[model samples]
Structure formats: C-alpha cells, structure tokens
Target: MTSATNPATEELTPFPDHTQLPDSDGTFVKNWQEHPQSILLTDSITPILKQLHPEGEYCIGQDLGIYWRLTDPPEKGAEAPDWFYVGNVPPLLDGLTRRSYVLWREFIAPTIVLEFVSGDGTEERDKTPWKGKFWVYEQVIHPAFYGIYEVQKASVEVYELIGGQYQLLSPNERGHYPIPPMGVELGIWQGEYQNTDLPWLRWWDLPGNLLLTGEERAEQERQRAEQEHQRAEQERQRAERLTAQLRALGVEPEA
Candidate 1:
C-alpha cells in the first residue's frame, strides 16, 4: 500500500493530556457593560497588540487578579488592573482571577498596565490610598508604562516608571506616549464606536498619530470617493461649457 493511503496515519487519534491541563477556574467577571466605552477601547487595542507581538507572552483583561504567591505565601491583597500585561510568561495564572501577580513565579511583572476609571466618585480614594497601589506597580512591579484613562474627563495620562518612582509621561499635542513595552503609544480621543461617538482610548505609533480602525478606514475611503465624484462632475460641466462656446463660434463641436 502507498504511504498516502496508510491506515495507521488515518487511524491516529490525538490524546488529551491530563498532567498539563488547562485551568478551569470559574472565577466570574461581571459583564463589562458597566463602562461600555472602556470596553471598546480595551477590546480594540489589545488583540492588535497581541497579534503584532505573537512571540511575546502577555495577558490583558479585567476582574482577573494576579496571585503573587510565588516567593511569599499567597497574599490576601490582589490588585486587578483594568488591563495588565506580563511579557514572556504564560497567559494563565492558576486558571483564575490571579490572587496576586507574584513576580518571582512568573519571572516578570507586568510590563504595562491600563486603569480605566469608572467614575464612581472614588477619584480621591484612587489618588491617595490607591496612590500607594499604583506606587507598588511603579516601585515594586516596575512596569515601564502605566496608563490611566478617564472617560468622563476625556483625559488619558501615562506614567513611566523612572528611578524607582512614577514620572508622568507628558503627552504631545495628541496626548500620548511611545511606550516600548507594547510597541504602541496609547492615546485618548473622541471617535465613533458601537454607533456612538465619544471619548475612547486609541493605539498610536511612536509618532503620536491615531491608528484608524477598519470601520474608520472604510469611512475615509467613502469620503475620498465622494470628493473624486464631485471633481469629475465639475470637469464634465467645464467641458460642456467649452463645447457650447465652440458651437456658437460655428466650429461644430463633435459629439
């Protein structure tokens, strides 16, 4: 029998490994509709970043906490970043909302973090006691960049971890920074998403320019087509006028 028709090859069945099984934790995340705009911003930027950095390992999402029990005993305090990332590490943490992102276990802390303020009037709380929280990320976590997106204020700010402290990375005219961790500068702007035009977080290049979404790109193409049509119409009208002038001069304009 030819190798192409080998029965052994056809009968091969893949077996599931029980020893290296996936995490089946039922840790719950309330539907993300609480802040619809933030959801769009997160959904839009993350997949692209992951796709671009296929070789690098990372995870970005909410309600999933990182458990930092790798070195110290599993700790009670777990911080859930709106969107957090750890480079060059497996994306799953015990298959559940991480108890705390223990750096030692994963051999790396999150490279960048994004915080979307829900505007529950806890700005002061976040600025003070929570200041220490981000401080931990700055001092201990040592993320290269930390972003705070304020939906109500339409403000986006990024803090770069510098010299064991958090230094605000000033935004250019467009309000963004070129962070190398994710290879994309995060920006805040007003745009259409889910049929609504409002403030949203956008990914940009190092040059501080907005990257267009598929929908936005399509809209631009439509606008360009309309402009081209108008220009052609204008040219046609001019040609007709010239033809009428030739007819009046008895030049007998051809059809």
Candidate 2:
C-alpha cells in the first residue's frame, strides 16, 4: 500500500504530529515470551494473506502502541493489543517509524486484535470502563474479532463482534475458531517454534491446514529438493545398469 503523502509539498507524511496525541503510558509491561509469541503469530499470518491476495495490503502490529482519543482527556484512551492486524492499510506509513497507531489518522480500526494472557493476569480480561483492555477493544476500537490466548491453559477464546457487542465464538471439530473474513482459524498448537517448546497460538486455513512460518516453508522446500535429487540419482543408476547389461549381451544400447 502506498504511504500517506502531502500532495502540496510532495513530501512523505506518515502520520500527523503525535505530540498532541497521547501515546503509550506504559500501563502494561510485556513478559519475555509475549513479544516472541506476538511475532510468531503475526509473521505466520501475513505471508498467507499475501499469497492469497497478491494485490491486498495489510498492517500488522506486534505490541506496537495504539492510540485513540475516545474521552475528554486524550491521554486516558489508549490501549495496545499484543498482536493486531488491519487490512487495506499501508504496512508502514511513508516508510517512517510509527510512534503509535492513531485511529483518527488511519481512519480504520484493526480487523482483528489478539491478546496473550500474561502470567500475572494483569489486564487481559479487564472490563472496567475506559481503563480496561476488554472495554477499550469492545467499546472503542471495536475490532471485528478479538482473541485471548492463555498459554497456561493452552486454550483460545475468540469473540466476534455481533450487534456492537462481542460474543464468544464456538470452536470447530478441530477445536479452532474460524475467522470467516480472514479465511483462517485460530487455535493452539503444542509444538516447538523458534526453539521454544510450548503450546503456541497459531493460524490455520479453513481446511485445517496449519499456516507455516517462513522457516518451516523453507525447510519443506529443502526436503522436497532432496527427495527429487535422490529420485533422479536412482533413475540414472538404473539406466546405467541396463546399458551395462545390453553391452554384456553384445548389443550396444543407443545413447
């Protein structure tokens, strides 16, 4: 997607002046695994979307601060989801670093927001008005889909916005919640990712195929190449044996 630019000066304008906007206040501190998990989830999802819609555009945030002024004091109305995705928006605005995602400037709320429940359980499910993450997402940001993944329980709870309120979604037979708009399912996978052995929240296609990371895709390609090489070598050896047998029988095989 093309970044926002000033037509008058022909200069790149990523975002409006952020000084007037209330950015992050550091209310929530991230755990060690939180960042990695967020990265894993976003990284795995983006490539699939790109492949499916080559002309599509998307913006993904991993613990990136999101700013919104829903109250009289703008400072009090900002909340950042662990991982969020907004479609039809530039991945980066004017190739500049984003201080925070300003909803007014972007003019679009994230399509999906995912929160990884921290060990302390500070604010993952907070529903207090204006201050809680749940309240902010449901009332203010109003993402189409909201998901909370608890690593301890190895469970995922997905909520879909219906009639302006978030309703808990039911999982399918494979225990995955289908996100129809995205054509993907959200679920927990018990496996190792980035050398960490744990239950990781991941994405799957509607047909129950797991969305693979870049590393996993590369590994699969390598294995396929190796198999092809072995097959070619076996065929070559078989042909050579047949030629040798023909020569021994005093009938030279044609090249």
Q: Number of the top candidate by lDDT?
A: 2
C-alpha lDDT score of every prediction, in listed order: 0.62, 0.82
Identify the runs in model 2 with alpha carbons over 4 angstroms from their true place. 1-29, 51-56, 70-75, 120-122
* lDDT comparing candidate 2 with the true structure: 0.82
Residue 129 lDDT, candidate 2, scale 0-100 = 86
The sequence of per-residue lDDT tens digits that candidate 2 reaches over residues 1-255 is 998876887866554444456566656665678877887887788877787557766777777667777555655657777888888876666776566788878878888999988765568778888778888899988899999888988998999999998999999999999998888999999999878999999999999999988888899999999999999999999999999999999998887
- If scored against the real structure, what TM-score would every candidate get? 0.61, 0.83
* Candidate 1 CA-lDDT value: 0.62
lDDT of 2 at 64: 67
Question: What's the CA error at residue 154 for candidate 2, in Å?
Answer: 1.1
For candidate 1, the per-residue lDDT at 39 reads: 60
lDDT score for residue 198 of model 2: 91
